[model samples]
Structures are given as structure tokens and as C-alpha cells.
Target: MDKQIETELEAAAFRGLLTHLQNHPEVQNIELMILADFCRNCLAKWYAEAAKERGIDIDYEQARDKVYGMPYAEWKDKYQLTATPEQMAAYEKRQKEKQ
Candidate 1:
């Protein structure tokens, strides 16, 4: 495939993934990071970095709102649940192993 076409396809796939994530608010970021080493915040950071590379202005909060489908605080208040001690421990263990 041509490079431009590949980039477009990747962008489309990323949009689809973002849409899926927005619809699955029950999936916590910690769980995602623990398992996949990336999550919504990671996506937002990537977006901001990409924008910077292109000389576009994309702030972290704006990028987060895009991935989250709303302000992060609103989403957290409405959908985020407190993690159990076991979940926290698992996340920490995974992070340590990742280091």
C-alpha cells in the first residue's frame, strides 16, 4: 500500500477504536494500562504529540475530551469506579515488570 493510504487507514482504525472506547466507559484505564500498557490517557498524549509534530495546537485536556467523548471530570464522575486493592496491586505489579 502507498504510505498516504496506509496513514489514512491507520487514522480511520484509530477513530474506530476511540469510538469503541467511548462506548465502553466501564473499562477502566488502569485495567487497560495493566493489561495493554496503554489507555485513554495514553491515546490523548499521543494525539497531543502528533498535533505538535504537525504544528497544530492540541492541548492535553482537549485531546482527552476527544478520546473520552466529554470532559474527563464529567466522565469520571459518571462512569469511573473506585479500584479495589487487588486491582491496584495487579496494576502496580504489571508496571514494575514493565520497567
Candidate 2:
């Protein structure tokens, strides 16, 4: 594929992923981290880094809003659930395994 075509395809796939995440608010960030080792925050950080690579100045919060479909605080208030003890334990186990 041509470079431009490849880039457009990649962008389309990313948008699809973002849309899927937005439609599935029940899939908590902790769950994503535990299962996939990356979450919305991770995506936001990556997005900000990409912006920096392109000589753009996008902060974490701005990237997060783009990912979360709202301000981080508002998203947390509206959709974030408290992780249970079991969830925390699983997360810790996953972190340990990564190290």
C-alpha cells in the first residue's frame, strides 16, 4: 500500500477503536489495563506523544478529552466505577507479571 493509504487506514482503525470504547463505557479502564495492559489513559498519552512528534502541543488532558469524549473529571464522575478489592488484586498480579 502507498504511505498515504496506509496512514489513512491506520487512522480509520484508530477511530473505530475509539468509537468502540466510547460505546462501551461499562468496560472500565482498570479492566482494559488488566486484560490489554493499556487503557484510555494510555491511549491519551500515546495521542499526546504523537502530537508532540508532529510538532503539535497537545497536553494529556486534551488528548484525554479526545479519547474519553469529555473532560477526564467529567468522564470519571459519569462513568468510572470504583474497582473492587478483587479487581485491585488482579491488577497487582498483572503488574507483577509484567515486571
Candidate 3:
């Protein structure tokens, strides 16, 4: 594919993934980290980095909003739950295994 077409396809795939994630807030970030090695916060960091690379002025909260489909605080208040000790332990084990 041409470079522009490739970029557009890539952007579309990203948007689809973002939309899926937005619709599935029940999927906890820690679960994503344990399973996929990254989560919405990782996406936000990458988004901020990409914006910086492109000389765009996007901060972490803006990037997070893009990923969360709302302000981070609102999302946190609504959907984010405290991880149980067992969940945290499993995530830590997964991270160690990855390393």
C-alpha cells in the first residue's frame, strides 16, 4: 500500500481499538497489563509521545481523555475499582515472567 493509505489504515485500526476499549470499561487496566503488557495508560503515554514527536501540544490528561472517552478523573470515579491483593500479586507475577 502507499504510505498515506498505510497510515490511514493504521489510524482506523487504532480508532477501532480505542472505541472498543471505551465501550468495555469493565476490562480493568491491571488485567490488560497482565495479559497484554499494556493498558489505556500505556496508550495515553504513547499518545502523548506521538503528539510531542509531531510537535503537537497534547498533555497526558488530553491523551488520556482521548483513550478513556472522558476525563480521567470521571472515568476513575466511575469504572476504576481497587485491585485486590490477589489481583495485584498475579499482575506482579505476570510482569516478572515477562521480564
Candidate 4:
């Protein structure tokens, strides 16, 4: 595939992922981290890094807003659930495994 076509395809895939995440608020960030070693926050950080690489001055919060489809605080208030003890333990285990 041409470079432009490949880029467009990747962009479309990213958009589809974002839409899926937005539609599934119950899939908490911690859960994503536990399952995939990354989460929406990771995505936001990557987004910000990419913008920086492109000479665009997008900050973390701005990237987060784009990924969350709203302000992070508002999204947290609306849908983010507190991690349970089990989840925390699992997360810790995952962290250790990463080391």
C-alpha cells in the first residue's frame, strides 16, 4: 500500500478503537491496563507525544480530552469506578511482572 493509504487506514483503525472505548465506559482503565498493559491514559500520553513529534503543542490534558471525548474530570465523575481490592492486587501483580 502507498504511504498515504497506510496512514489513512491506521487513522481509521484508531478512530474505531476510540469509538469502541467511548461506547464502553464500563471497561475501566485499570481493567484495560490489567488485560493489555495499557489504557486510555496511555493512549492520551501517546497522542500527546505524537503531536509533539509533529511540532504540535498538544498537552496531556488536551490529548486526554480528545481520547475521553470529554473533560477527564467529567468523565471520571460520570463513569469511572473505584478499583476494588482484587483489581488493585491484580494491578500490583501486573506491575511486578513488568519489572
Top lDDT: which candidate number? Answer: 4
> Tens digits of per-residue lDDT for model 3 on 45-84?
9999999999999999999999999999999999999998
Clash pairs for candidate 2: none
Q: Any idea how many clashes model 4 has?
A: 0
Clashing pairs in 1: none
Model 1: lDDT of residue 41: 96
TM-score of every candidate:
0.96, 0.98, 0.96, 0.98
**Clash totals for all models, in order?**
0, 0, 0, 0
Error of 4 at 7 (Å): 0.4
User: Residue by residue across 1-99, what tens digits does model 4's lDDT show?
Assistant: 999999999999999999999999999999999999999999999999999999999999999999999999999999999999999999999999999
Candidate 1 wrong stretches, greater than 4 Å: none
lDDT (Cα, tens digit) per residue for candidate 2, span 1-99: 899999999999999999999889999999999999999999999999999999999999999999998898998998999999999999999999999
Q: Model 1: per-residue lDDT, tens digit, 1-99? A: 999999999999999999999999999998998889999999999999999999999999999999999999999999888998988999999989978
* Root-mean-square deviation of Cα positions for candidate 3 versus the true structure, in angstroms: 0.8
Q: How much lDDT does candidate 4 score?
A: 0.97
lDDT at 65 for candidate 4? Answer: 95
Q: lDDT per model, in order? A: 0.94, 0.96, 0.96, 0.97
Q: What is the C-alpha RMSD of each candidate to the true structure, in Å?
A: 0.7, 0.6, 0.8, 0.5
Candidate 4 wrongly placed segments (more than 4 Å): none
